[model samples]
Target: MTSRYLDYSGNMDGELRMPGKDKHFQNTEDRTDSGLDSLKDEDYNRIVSGVQNLCIPVSATPQDYEPEPWKVQNNEDGDTLLHLAVIHEAKDLAEEAIRRSYRDGYYLNRQNNLYQTPLHLAIITEQAEIAEKLLQAGCDPEIRDYRGNTALHIACQRGSLRGVGVIVQYSKFQLPSLLTCYNYDGHTCLHLASNNGYLAIVEHLISLGADINAQEPCNGRTALHMAVDKQNPDLMYLLLKHGADVNKVTYQGYSPCQLTWGRENSQIQQHLLSVTEKSLQYLPESEDEDSSDSESEHSDDEYMYDDCKLMCQGLN
Candidate 1:
């Protein structure tokens, strides 16, 4: 049998025995070079396990010990070390804290000065894996901070479909009701995604059975209207394919086709006009006529905050 030592720089030496193993082997080289043969043998695995079990980190003064903090959890910046860990790719320490939080139900909504969550930072920084892990750990996906926007909205605004997928996985139907989910700008996640040319996010929102034609207050802009404003022909094509009413008018009396026709997206304008005329070939009787009148507008602003508080208390 041969003795082995593991070093911080991943250097392995045969002469240096593992700590606590005072007995040295005479035939170190004869037992096969290095620990490869031992690794393949069960007896070697047991020896390695025993060595690991006996290992302990070197101690230091309280100030220097554990010098690396995982999160920047302070009132000034809402970011947690977990947020930065994911942002900067700090794996081991972040994983340890994440496991602890998972067990203790640590609801980390720490925002940096930006008032964003670890999840929000994940999306902004394009950390798809960390975002997924954080969501699974129960960081509220529907949570809104100072700007009154949810993680979904932030993902959409940044056009991070990868991040959006991580959020939508948790946010499908689970959420804190009060977030109105409508931001202070009076828009939904779908609205922001559609407005910002995030075709993939729009597709995901629609796949979740979101109202494709839902409008915002302050003049009633539909997804199609916002898509038109972005001059995105593909987005217009997507909205129309998803049953956007080309003839349906905004409060300003501008229909999708009208807005389309006025845009720089001449190809979209022509295509939308053609579709509007083609759809008029035959139409169904008014089923959602009255339903359309009562748009999904939230009259009470504080309702969302109150609902969020109630849900948080319940979870607590």
Candidate 2:
């Protein structure tokens, strides 16, 4: 009845050794005389039950297991699966993620490290259909990127007419507010479209009820003023045709016509002049008592503002 135990030392040889001793014993016991024979039947059954309880059954299908919540988010840029899908142009995967998130909707609006939601990336990447799907899935069109430009603003800036149309249509009750929402540079969708000379996008925004006369907060320049500054006669004409106030003046007291003074686009200048009030047609006199104010305004770059400089460069 001498007891022996399986050797668990560094050796691979399957020799039995007594506890507290270095000598090896031959494993000559009959199978029935092994360690299991020493345990009571109930003890053996209990050990078996414990092992069975600790075992986890393998899932029959991948769908049967849910992943950890953190796995859904990309570690690098905090982009979720939906964001990555849109970024890589994996439309089917994006659609699937969107479908699964329909009930939660929170993930639909989740922004990545750049504060850009999947919808923003969709429009920026020119995936109009995916943008629409995101909008339809309750993605908030109002969510802005780090630049404070909403998806709609990006759409207009990038001259994506379909992007603009889809965002406006899906915005439903929020369409009017969204059209007028300003980015960090104080440029609305209309201003971006107008500044970029996106005549079609400007027309589309105006048709959708964007405030044609909405003044950018930076210098109080309206879409009309921007069109004049860009010297885009077609855009100017479109703005005027859509009721853009030609008399609208910048914070510097220069009307759209005044902004046209040194520009070479005679057509825009003449059209603005024809419509602008006579008093606003002339630039503010440089020698007037308010000369210092006008001088200070001129010292700053007329078209450049904070992050807007980067945006303009990107658009170009």
Candidate 3:
């Protein structure tokens, strides 16, 4: 597995408010009241107690007692009922907490100890249904965890195309940003998907316009390099078909083809070489309009010689 870039300093304390903040809040309150009206009083009480037990910390001293639920609630780690629900995989509890948050106007995007929101937890835990619920409830998918990974990045890392779809569809404002998002390691969604051999996620990401050739910050290695390095010929072919630049070299000047050397992916090297040879033919004419035919012929010969030399090196 590729190394994960997970780290953070101080805990971030904030939340993303939905658009039309005041109106959304009013609507949420109304919907929550209607939902509560539909439930038996005892059921509602149980849900409230469950949420409180999971989210609110108990008072160690009498002086710590506060009448305000918002003030008194939240564990020492800052995980809300929603966060706990996703972490515990309690779908019913998660849905109830979501309702309560809407009813009470809680911060849906609040970061816990790990700086992950309820939505992030849902996706990370592979609860696609809950993840969808969070998105439909307007949880911000763009919120980064401590590791600077948005829900989209995590979805890709986990190879959850369904989760990715929910994010891509719901995070309208964050879509463009999400497509280009880089985690702490500078790995994009495409990079993660390809590295992990998640063909479905890769296809979805590419269709959504992920930069197929985006390079990692540390190595400048694109998805193609990762695919080649991982000896995934299928992934390599997918990347190539989607317009990944075959000759793109990393900071160390090693192209995907070069990276395949000494690896067990002779097929990948051969495909890259063939593609390179074809691309060379389309190179813009180097000669001026008046330049001699001989000069153009010489340039073509040199290009072919370079191509042959690279092929020989690859074979060796």
Clashes of each: 12, 0, 0
Ranking the candidates on TM-score from highest down gives: 2, 3, 1
Ranking by lDDT: 2, 3, 1
Candidate 2 residue pairs in backbone clash = none
The model with the greater TM-score, 1 or 3, is 3
Candidate 1 residue-wise lDDT, 1-316, digit = tens = 1334554334454333434555444333545366566464677667755655443333344454332344434443555667667667787766666766662224355566666777776777777887787777777776665677777778788888887777766765663342236776667788888888888878877877777877776557788878777788888888888888777666655677665532476787777767675543222234135434323322342465456545543443
Residue 276, model 3: lDDT of 66
CA lDDT, every model vs. true structure = 0.65, 0.77, 0.73
lDDT of 2 by residue, 92-141 (tens): 99998888776344667788898999999999999999998888878888
Q: Which candidate do you rate higher for lDDT, 2 or 3?
A: 2
Model 3 Cα lDDT, one tens digit per residue, 80-129: 76777789898898887776555232367788988888888888898988
Which ten contiguous residues of candidate 1 have the minimum total lDDT? 279-288
TM-score, one value per model:
0.59, 0.70, 0.65
Q: What's the lDDT of the predicted structure labeled candidate 1?
A: 0.65
